[model samples]
Target: MLKSSGMWWYEQFARYRYRQGMTYARKGQYHLAISRFNRALLHHPQPDEVCIARGLIYLRLGDLEAALADLDRAIALNPCNSKAYGNRGLVKAQLGDEAAALEDWRVALTHRPCYAEARYNRGLVFAHQKNYQYALDEFDLAIKANPNLAEAYLHRGNVRDELGDRFGAAKDWQLALLNDLSLDAAKKALFRTRRESHEQRLTEKLGAVLAPLDLSLQVERQGRQLNLLIQREPGTPVNYQDVAKLLQAKIVDLNLNWLERFRIIGRMGTGGMPDWDKVYQIYDNCACPPIYLSRILASLLFFMPFGIAAIVYATQVKANYAQGNYRAALTASKLIKWFYWVSLGVFSATASLVVFGVVLLLLRGESLSSIIESIRTMPSPRPYLGRPYADPHPDPSPQPSLPESTDSSAD
Candidate 1:
């Protein structure tokens, strides 16, 4: 009877420590939380709850080996712990063990039939393996389980495209967009596919016209504009006016509003030749609102206000440049130039005032050495206070807990 009472006391203390560890973990003091969890484990080594909690903390810290060990122990202690299995799958996936990860996810699903995360993860693995049909099935089930699963819809669209169902793919993509899915790869794939189709049609129409002139052309889409490269054989005489007329006719026939910003370049000869190339913009549409907005935001930086707006516009410049929007970048560069000049003037003025004040102080009663001594004698400022708590072990929450939401792992 006495031994049983002692065991009960130990379990209660261990539970108390575990609760304290969880509090520290929520507050982002990971190291202190892990220490408390270790103490809790020392009291009840076989408790699956402690193992699972510590395993999650290890995963957060990127200690895959320790996380795997604890998760594996938790699963062994209680095979029905769906949270443990799901987390083990995450660790295995991170470690590049896709086959084992899939099995763990399946086990998690078997334990809890409505496990949306496990279903989604299984679909990801299937997609990676090129099993599009299986992946589609899993994604469908995941979406059915949780209709708001944006990633599942995005991947489903990818599978539909892989299966050559363009109409279905478009529908799925629209649904994904409606759900506000932010999948960069999916968006890029859609853009590239559409651009290739447009290029193919344009090439067919331009091929016959170029054949008679003995000039070959290549068309490329760069961001919001099309670039046409006209190449001629060496020693061939080209009429710039005639070539421009022909290109302009073709662009008018196509009637694409975005193509109005096209650029045309002509080159002759194989090797380097003197003044053998001509480059010019086809249209004058420089008053684009996005570019104007960027420029205006950049100008505001000169007032020593809206510092964050300046940073945002600078980022916009880089993004536009990366997207091959040269006109937008050029316009935005004006703002950056103004900001540079204004900041230089401000810095110079501030430095001049500091120098004048120091000179005045020296001319008066203060010596440089005395100023240094006074600065040294000043008292240090107090450190910022952290979370306040008298005891390391606090009371536990009344409600039961499960694993943290799966969205964190997706990020």
Candidate 2:
């Protein structure tokens, strides 16, 4: 017979059977595991642990009645078993007896005060009953017991939101994601709250500007910024530049949590509505796009036409610069560097292809030598003029010859 471990060589049948039952349970063979647990209980002195393990399996399989029976028997065997009470609470909760489930949780908590799982379960029940204050307390206790509990933070955030503590809710959601990055619900909650606050401020401030113009402001989110489209009568005359300037001047004093850019589109000009990009920031250093001297110098040195043209355009377009057009400014300022990199990229690719072809040709030449050698080594490839490389077709005409030496024997 083969033993599984050194301890298994002398282990008793009851403990062995219990371990096998646990192994089968871990492998998700519920029915086979139940039979193994039954067999182990017949020989084991303590049946509470076995019953608790089997009950958990039954609970996972959705057999509430069997799980409840097993848990009740486990509690009878050991009145101090907090696990039995806690899991029985879950079964009762599923059975639609909220009052009895709460009672079970109370007993479980009394048996083990620091049980984080029990506290979390109680928080869910409290939240469901709309007792948000009690739910918040339970979740706080659970988090205190186990600081890394992401679900506890998540539910606590919901309770805080229900209690009108939005700041606390946002903080809780942030903490939940810090503990578990996979909590996308928490991540979305945080993003939504931030966007709401930002858009609310924008609407109030920007909405006031549109009041006197007989226009309505429609704000649509475009990534991290807001796109403001001024809605008006089809034939109404409106200058895109004037509206953009008005929006920019009024938005300078506003405070925001997230938005930094606002794109304004007013009435159609000679062309359609122009997209006016203005970036607003609280900090003085970020109020305008930065102008780096090194960038201009590098552009002028490596790429000539783009650097010179961009610098000239940047200087000529005073209104464009004053309007804080981010994209145009980047193009003017970074054109030289962009061109230098693009040219270098193209040259490097060509050089790489050439190098690869050279290496391939060398390898091909080496293989050709093997073929040539093999042909020469064959029995007799051809009756050539004692040289394998000689031309097979000999010239029939007499070749040009040097003058014969005067002392040659004429035989």
Candidate 3:
């Protein structure tokens, strides 16, 4: 009723109330936030905004039924509202419907390819199901979407630990702490990961491996230095230098990641730290390849097919590296760079169209809403990566096709 020529006063009030609700929610005052959202709903023409806001508060308050109802209303009001779908996916996951949750997240990503929270939630479920590999992949996508997401790093570290990539896990825990200083869980996990016991275990493994050569190892300087000696049995035919070189090669073939953490200074007839350079070579060979996360982000913003390709290759670089498939990781890294350039070219064309397309639409008497819808439904880039992942849900009643996913980082 309070409309002006250029703006709707009701919309202004709705936005004001929505900001107030968000402030309250951030302060953990969910009930007050819900009240503000309800008031905003009364004046809002597009009720989905209020519905999604209220639904999120209800979800935070553990009122699953209320949250589900609000989210469903939001979806009904605006099927293209990716925020509603992502939140509903969380609700579905909590309600013991993991498959449904996955489906919702897939649809959400179809709408918004860079939805970090949806990816994070999906990763959590996968981790819970013991699908560590899939969980790690999803976490990679979440990190790519929002690099400062500490929880994603923390959980990804857990998945890496489960997969026995303790080195990578420790690195992730460190990154989590770097991003969120107050995250006590990350602090504790990192401390546990780097305890002295790890050094002690490494020392024992090295000693065991070197015993058969009539050689002894003494771990010194707090496990950073190694002292070596040969048991000079009289009339022994073995050449000490040849034995040392052979041991070094055998250590390299051991493929122990922790070996690089120490300087194996030879002593008593064996060469110095240079003899152990093979271990460092092993670390260098197995290192993960380039991620190209930022390039993939640009691709996602403009064209999803290239984004998909970039994401797959970027993820492969890490996954393959973790499994010691350095060749494959490098191959994927090269492929990602190629896709990055292709994506850039596509984005250039898309940007050119966007700058001029708006003018053409407006000149033809098209409204902003219709223009947005046209962009959302823009002929699916099927030849590249196919339509958004919104297949069909298992609801008894038929539902309409969904739009793109929503980025929680933006929300």
Candidate 4:
């Protein structure tokens, strides 16, 4: 057999294996890629490409330490390798070393200014830190480099919103929606900005009757402030009672964690075995229970009467307003305010009553001890029977029988 050229032999063996490893990595056959990369590494001991390929394979498999080792060796072997730094930065980011990751990305950018991946990753790091301006700038550059990048526009829109540029943010979000309709952030923006041609009835009514121009222009008639934004939608009718019911439903999601914990504790409390106490102790030691249920109870106690008063007042106010009885509605609103104060007073008094009763019980256990003593010291009662124990003298022989009084009239 003819002797093969050294370069050709290396190409046939080492290069072929490295290319095969890359193919395997692309197919997500991480283990096979690792094996192929190792074989290639043995043949081409100092090859930066082989080292980088192995690093990428390790990174894909979540083997951060192995990825870092390969990346470090690759960087050492070729100090000017911007791709190695970029790959290493991604691994560092996955490990939560933002500082190290940013540094690597920065180095990658300095070496290869057009590295879009590094720039985008660095921008995300900035966004994670809430440094939105810098994040926005980086995203701007990323978009310039790759104009079709929908994610850059989305994040830039978020950053703009964070910086109080609602119009700009809306524009960006709209563009993002056009690019990718799946994004909920963009959809929310579109919803909020959407408006119809129908005139607000409250605005028209308030405008016609009220005075001082601006004061009369509000969607709601709440004194002189003229704040219209607080009013609910005009025509798409919603039952306030049903809204309150739905609000209670939505509130359940907020307390689910504590509810689950309480359920567990409640179940334990019902068990016959004393082991529940140990479980409770362990849970208490590990995590303090949320006071949300207590807060909910306290808040209900705090606001229930006022809530009922408002509900009662609302029907009267709406009915009066509808009947063109503005004065009655105004009076009803004042009464509502008065009821709020009264409810506050009642809640305070009720709480005081509870505290006072608790203190009384703590001091003297229902006053039973004193009551028992008073009863013990009192004279005993004689039993009633057929036979009497004592009798008083007959009432002095009945004072001589009274003369026939009826004869006085005849005399």
Assess the local accuracy of residue 20 in candidate 2 as a C-alpha lDDT between 0 and 100: 90
Per-candidate Cα lDDT values, in order, are 0.77, 0.77, 0.78, 0.65
| Higher-ranked by TM-score: 1 or 3 | 1
TM-score preference between candidates 1 and 2, better one: 2
* Regions of candidate 1 where Cα sits further than 4 Å from its true position: 1-28, 40-46, 164-174, 180-218, 229-244, 260-280, 283-411
Best candidate, TM-score: 2
- Clashing residue pairs in all predictions, respectively, total 0, 0, 5, 0
TM-score of candidate 3 against the unseen true structure: 0.49
Question: lDDT of model 1 at residue 93?
Answer: 94
lDDT of 3 by residue, 155-182 (tens): 9999999998989998999999899999
What is the TM-score ranking, best to worst?
Answer: 2, 1, 3, 4
Specify the poorest-scoring 10-residue window by lDDT in model 2: 280-289
Model 1 TM-score is 0.53
Order the candidate numbers by lDDT, best to worst.
3, 2, 1, 4
Off by over 4 Å in 4: 1-4, 44-46, 174-411
Least lDDT summed over 10 consecutive residues: which range in candidate 1?
283-292
lDDT per residue (tens digit) for residues 53-140 in model 2: 9999999999999999999999999999999999999999999998899899899999999989889999999999999889989999
Give the residue spans of candidate 2 off by over 4 A.
1-11, 211-326, 330-411
Clashes of 1: 0
Task: For residues 1-411, write the lDDT of model 1, one tens digit per residue.
Answer: 355877888978998999999999999898999998998987773589899999999999999999999999999999999999999999999999999999999999999998888898999999989999999999999998988877888888889888988767767777777787576766766676677778867766765567788887777888766777677887877786677667756664455656545566677754454333444454332222133444444445444554444555666776776776744665565566666556657667888997898788889989999877877898999898987878778778687789787655663
Q: Residue-wise lDDT of candidate 4 within 1-411, one digit each (tens)?
A: 655587557756977788888899889898898888888876673588788889988887779999999999999999889999999999999999999999998998889997877778888999989998899889888878777677777888878878878778878888887788898977876555432111244345433432322222223222222222212222333333332233223323223222212111111122343211111111221222122233333434677866565556656876776676544565566666666566667789999997886677757766756655765899888777678666676666656676665645663
lDDT of 4 at 267: 14
